[model samples]
Target: MTNHSHPSTTTTHSFKDLISMRQAVQSLFLAISLFMGIMFYLFVAQLESGAMPTLERPPGVEAFLPISALISLKYFLFTGVFNTVHPSALVIFLIVCTTALVVRKGFCSWVCPIGLMSDGLAKIHSWLFKRPVHLPTWVDLPLRAIKYTIAGFFVWSVFFKMPLAAVEQFIQSPYNTFADIKMLDFFTNISTTSLCVISVLIILSIIVKNFWCRYLCPYGALLGVISFFSLGKIKRDKNNCIKCGKCETMCPGRISIMENETINSLECSACLRCVDVCPAPNAIGFSLVSGKVPMDQRKIALVIIAAFLTGITTAKATGHWQNGTRIQAYQEHVLQDRMSSQPPMKIPANTDPEKMKRMIERMRQKKN
Candidate 1:
């Protein structure tokens, strides 16, 4: 005779037991923090040389819309860095559309280095305060609306049938030139106003959890919208209900996962804390409806499509795409030339404008 029994399961988990859950969330946060550090170093290296990489130029480049980068790349490519009012700046304006679409707003939780830093601050706050801070819904909800208003103003101002020539002139100006710098010496020497704005944002992050992403980040608003269509979602199994309240307590975003099987796609980070902390097995999970999403297999394809359409549309409508190609080609040529004699050429502020203009004009003429 053989005796067999199912594995005994605990009905409850202590707060200490949730260490694994915390670590899981922290792990994602740490990975992003490391990535941001590397990016900061790379950006500094590029800044010293005065050359910005394609990645560096675009803020939130990997996000679905990446309007900041798109608009900036467009401006840089079309009119050169001397123009102050280039059409490429309109890329940040696409939040209106991104928000109305898929609600993945993963930009805040997943992509933005600054956003990640803000999250790290929140973690620190939890450690120091030893309690979660809760703002009234009336206060928190309305404050959240400010980002869109800022975004709306930005869009209306940039796209209000402005003269293309005027736009090109603005982007080429010195203020716009250093706006994309890494170490931001541009603030010290050229534009204190831009520097002050950046400084204030950094300080604000220390006091408020995701203050930048939640209220100020136009990119977050955009991704928050794209998240709506994301196939992978956090779901709860209501049938296995104990109403333990652990998931609600543990959620960083303060979402009540116990009540709804489907966490609002806009807020969930896919952090899996809800899943990991659940005393009941299979109560919460990341899943595809009907079939699994091929996000991994299809990522490259999606990126290509996103890049192509965003590029072409921004180009035809705003004429920034042509400029980006020209700038990139010139950069590649410069890098190759530097490799021949010295280290990778750090672009200098004193770079030959005539040479750059000639190169860019030729590319533009050919493309036309």
Candidate 2:
């Protein structure tokens, strides 16, 4: 089954080095996420102050608006129109899904913020416990189904249930246009319930490797399903196999690497850690199913990263990278959502008239 005919020996990276490359890629994306968050926050803050924003809104912030993207995707399919409400959201969603079709769940391992966090927590689990924890099979099977269940609901609701009219209305709604702001608000002003749930998830992830990615993330579930048709997978060679269980243990997906000739599990992210830990030079490696040419470890990150770069470049060139929503509209929506319900502060009669006038003027300026 191993089609990796005489894999190249010149590559200097071991499994450890491969892991380092993965971390570097993860860090790069994480930094991009943070920068976008900060810039987006600043832009929103200016809008809230009823002032024109000094910074241009980072369209990448729309990446957090996945539901909006799903609606836009549907709307586009029926009407042949790419709505300007949140163009980058759809662009980002398309890029991510395309990567799944091309590289399995590599996005989860190399680029997901959650994946980066989980890796850190997994190390903590290692330090805190002497033995690796494994969930009982009977209990584990149902637990892992939760993500697919959640993903299925969204897929059915958007694709099968929502009509084109409703999809278009949603795309044009204030909720969709301002969703990126709301997403920021979800973090900046999180509800008690959301905080509690997040904390619980973190604690659980410490106890269980990748609790969210493995069993709770609808996004990951969607990617995993699409990845079934992915071009690249970890194909194993039976003849070159050493029976050592290192690959299985190193796998973040917790796949039984030795049992199968190819790592075809939805859980496999094609992180290539399995290739790194294999002690034998040609014992095992990632081989594309279409042909015998094995994918080099160094090129895996390049492939995924290049896919993103190419997609984003193309989107920008095609005028779909940014939304056409006006800044004035964002300002109007922000006040309508955030401040219209707020009552004016009652001025005490004891206060001076000039001070009262100043306060009232400030409020008027903010409302404007």
Candidate 3:
């Protein structure tokens, strides 16, 4: 006689479990938001004041998004580091890109401040509209290309031009003075056209979930392309699926999880919404092998270990995780000395080119 076992008993996870999982991931997202805000503030402060007290980058910055890969690319091609090599930029970019490999754009969902704001806006849109809205495919696809175009422009700017004098000026400019801060006063004083573009993007993000990431964020586009080879992925066991469709609804990307069973590597963010919502016991999970590992408790420990190693290795390589406070204090002192020596100079009412040149020379001397 064959004994029949009920599936419900095998997988008894409840809504509370799903909520707990969401909270865990969302808290991580919050931490990332806080970190980005700090970075943005630093960028603004350095640019606005034209001086900054030197502060070492936090270890987490080495592997953060937009920084590492861009820096690595710059360093590799020129045999010199550019904006990509700055400690904060390098760490953030690395973390985003590497995490993308493990969890398919997890950085966007779990770390990006802009993404968090977009997510919040999406909720507001839903509440106000009282319905979920989707853009038509024709319009959506074309708009998504914008991000790629932006990425291309940035890459081209760095690689295509070899203007030695201009590059020298930029390299020696406030960028280096401020420890390679990307935010500049000019950015804060952006033209109307730029403001319009940013406004449109934010508006679009509210209208559509992940609108910027899906189509227009050059950084996300770059990372998505890199994520093609990420090891960990969301895998679905087709035989075990009961067509619940919960995963699909829960997916912020709006991917059809029920039909495909396999999450798209380029689109999935490893938010674990699908995993927690899955009713099938051990049916959906992340693994190096497709659908092979369930990411059980033991593997979760391994994942933490891997993340830690990734962080530490990155910090050590970039001089961000250095030991002792005395060295750090010295670095801070040097930065302060540099800043105090070059307070923002008011331009004199000059009537001649010679006078302007003299002023420029004085400024250059101060910078040096």
Error of 1 at 215 (Å): 2.2
Measured over all alpha carbons after superposition, the RMSD of each candidate to the real structure, in angstroms, is 12.0, 3.4, 7.2
- Candidate 3: list runs displaced more than 4 Å: 1-29, 32-72, 77-85, 152-199, 280-283, 296-309, 312-314, 317-368
C-alpha lDDT score of every prediction, in listed order? 0.51, 0.84, 0.58
Displacement of residue 143 (Cα, Å) in model 1 is: 1.1
Q: Write the per-residue lDDT of candidate 1 for residues 246-330, one digit (tens) a residue.
A: 8777765677777775666456654445655667655555544412432211231243236435754764575443223244443
Give candidate 2 regions above 4 Å deviation: 1-11, 341-368
lDDT of 3 by residue, 1-368 (tens): 01011112133556566445444555665686468557755644553454543544443433333433453455545655434224444444555566667656666665566666776787877886766777888987688778878987877776675454554454444434343233333354577988898889778777777677777778877767777787666666677778888877777777777666456656676666677677776556665556443443234434544664677586668664432223333345446655775868676566687888898899889976
Q: Tell how far residue 299 is off in model 3, in angstroms.
A: 6.2
**Residue 200 in candidate 3, Cα distance off native in Å:** 3.7
Q: How far is candidate 2 from the true structure (C-alpha RMSD, Å)?
A: 3.4
lDDT of 2 by residue, 1-368 (tens): 43344242235677678778889999999999999999999999999887889999999988888888888888888888989889999999999999888778889999989899999999999998888787898988899999999999988999999988888888888878788988998999999999999999999999988988988999999999999998787766778777888888888888988898766798988788777777766766665655365676567788889988998899899999889999889988887877664887687879999988898899889856
lDDT of 2: 0.84
Steric collisions counted per model: 35, 1, 18
